[model samples]
Target: MHIWDVTNGARFSTYAIRADEGSGIISLNGGAARHVQVGDLIIVAAFASMSEAEAETFKPNLVYVDGSNTITHTNHSIPTQAA
Candidate 1:
């Protein structure tokens, strides 16, 4: 299990899992976790059930690619809130 304090302007945490051919997709549990938005920079704290090869290829900060794609990395950084 991975623990991340994403309150520092970061957004969602993405995980790439290798599953069955027909079950290769991302799933997000939206109960208390915040949903990631487009052009948001994210920081990865921990990764489980993922290989080193896949982890290296995966970007830390991910921007929304499209309606179909939820995780994508952006050149811009996530904005910080004022105290």
Candidate 2:
């Protein structure tokens, strides 16, 4: 997974997912905090791998979230791989 910082346009690749939360909110820790700060806007993306045949037929789900990280809308689209 990768976390993209909205402020300075920084990208942090992380594998750790924190389970603890405060005020019913999940917070970033470790290396994620070094690139991300409090009240900073960020986009977290996770990817799944499949067989080549599955990839040819697989459709990815795109989630549109609001400022508070609430899912406002979603749609399915084919995944694109960069060269």
Candidate 3:
């Protein structure tokens, strides 16, 4: 998984997930913690490589959350960005 700091044009970094269910925590550990500050918005994405057959049937899970990190909705596809 990679964490993208969407609010400040910060660089994205790969990270492993930790269990903190319901804690609403999304932290950048170690030295990477400096890359973010409280209240900064971020996008967390996970990617996987699969074969042609698997790709044909795959749909990425997209989770939507509120400011508190509580999931409000979820779907497999994202809407196209508007101008």
Provide the lDDT at 52 for model 3. Answer: 98
Candidate 1 has a TM-score of 0.26
In model 1, what are the clashing residue pairs, if there are any?
42-61, 62-72, 63-72
Report model 3's TM-score to 2 decimal places. 0.86
Number of the candidate with higher lDDT, 1 or 2 = 2
User: Model 1: how far is 9 from its true place, Å?
Assistant: 18
Off by more than 4 A, model 1:
1-15, 19-24, 28-60, 70-73
Q: Compose the digit string of candidate 1's lDDT tens values, residues 1-83.
A: 23233444534445545555544243444531455443333344443467879866765553444334444446544467999
Candidate 2 residue pairs in clash (backbone atoms < 3 Å): none
lDDT of 1: 0.46
Per-residue accuracy of model 2 over 1-83 as CA lDDT, tens digit each: 88888888999788855654432344677767788777777777788888999988887788776656666888897467999
Measured on C-alpha atoms, candidate 2 has an lDDT of 0.74
Each model's Cα RMSD? 9.3, 4.5, 1.6
Predicted candidate 3 versus true structure: per-residue lDDT over 1-83, tens digit per residue: 77788888677666776867788777778877888888988888788889999999898899999998999999987678899
Off by over 4 Å in 3: none
